[model samples]
Target: MSLTNKAERSLISHEEYEIVRLTHHPDIYDVAGEDLQATRKRLRDLQEKERTLAREKRRISRGKAEPRGGSFPGTQERPSQRKQVFAAAVKRLSREIDRRARIAARAPQAEIAERALAMRRENFNASHAAADTANEGMQVIASRRRRTTVHPGKVGRVSQRTKAAQARRDAKG
Candidate 1:
């Protein structure tokens, strides 16, 4: 009979019967009718056989020996350090902007106001430039799956209202 047909004919599968048969077999018996040494030897032999099989499997998987040297140098900085530097720079710039805005609000004269606006624009540009550098650095550290958003300062379009107001103010001046 075929192996499959023989297995089907048995009370249980061939594999299951083998396991049951092995479990019931006594390897050695002492004067007290207890098998200690035989059981230990059998268990040890089974464990050694399993280890040998595992080693063979690993050797088969790694067909060729791995190389010992030739590691590439990493260029990217840590995310936390980059974030800390960016945050500190942004905070300092924000405080400067608030201080200038307050001074402009309190001061009188169109010339002073224009100067303040110019200073504000310069400050904004400088901060954005730093932020752009940080963002580029972040691209190297950030996950490949993440998407980047453009900063408002980097956007080139001027609003219609802003353009119209600038025109009116220029005409008045």
Candidate 2:
């Protein structure tokens, strides 16, 4: 079955699907913006969704429910395969949730480090004011720009094979 059809017919709610979709994007954290509390809430919601998906997946995997025939809503996949689809969705969502949660957990520490650096800069500037005045008449030579180790041309280049591999990986996950 096609990927979009499978995802659309997953047992997860619309909001949960949207969250999972956003988490797959490269710039997901940027979409969350500068709000730490909002990030926390989003993480909470995702965690809850993950838990729910997991429960549903577990129930299906257990075979406690009777196997139903026919295609699921909005998909060509048979109802019998809904278990696999839910499992795949839960696994993908869980991986992304873990990654996002780790980044979100570190955000506060990053903010603290930034504030400490700012304070250090302020103190350094206050102490260096006199030195700055003493060197006011001196001619300053411009420093050479530092060359980076990474080549720009080699950055972010994904081969067609790699793209296909990723697509397969996503489908499986």
Best-fitting candidate, measured by TM-score? Answer: 2
Using Cα atoms with residue i matched to residue i, what is each candidate's TM-score against the true structure? 0.20, 0.30
What is candidate 1's lDDT per residue for 80-144, written digit by digit as tens? 33223223323433444455567777766777889878876756555332433543432122225
Per-residue CA lDDT of candidate 2, range 1-173, in tens? 52564455374456545644544446454553444345446645555545554565466679876545544445322433434444444465456567778988999999999998887665555533333345455323333799668677666565766899999999998
Model 1's alpha-carbon lDDT is 0.42
Show where candidate 1 strays beyond 4 Å: 1-75, 109-173
Which ten contiguous residues of candidate 1 have the minimum total lDDT? 27-36
User: What is the number of backbone collisions in each predicted candidate, taken in the order shown?
Assistant: 0, 0
Segments in model 2 whose C-alpha atoms lie over 4 Å from true places: 6-80, 126-173
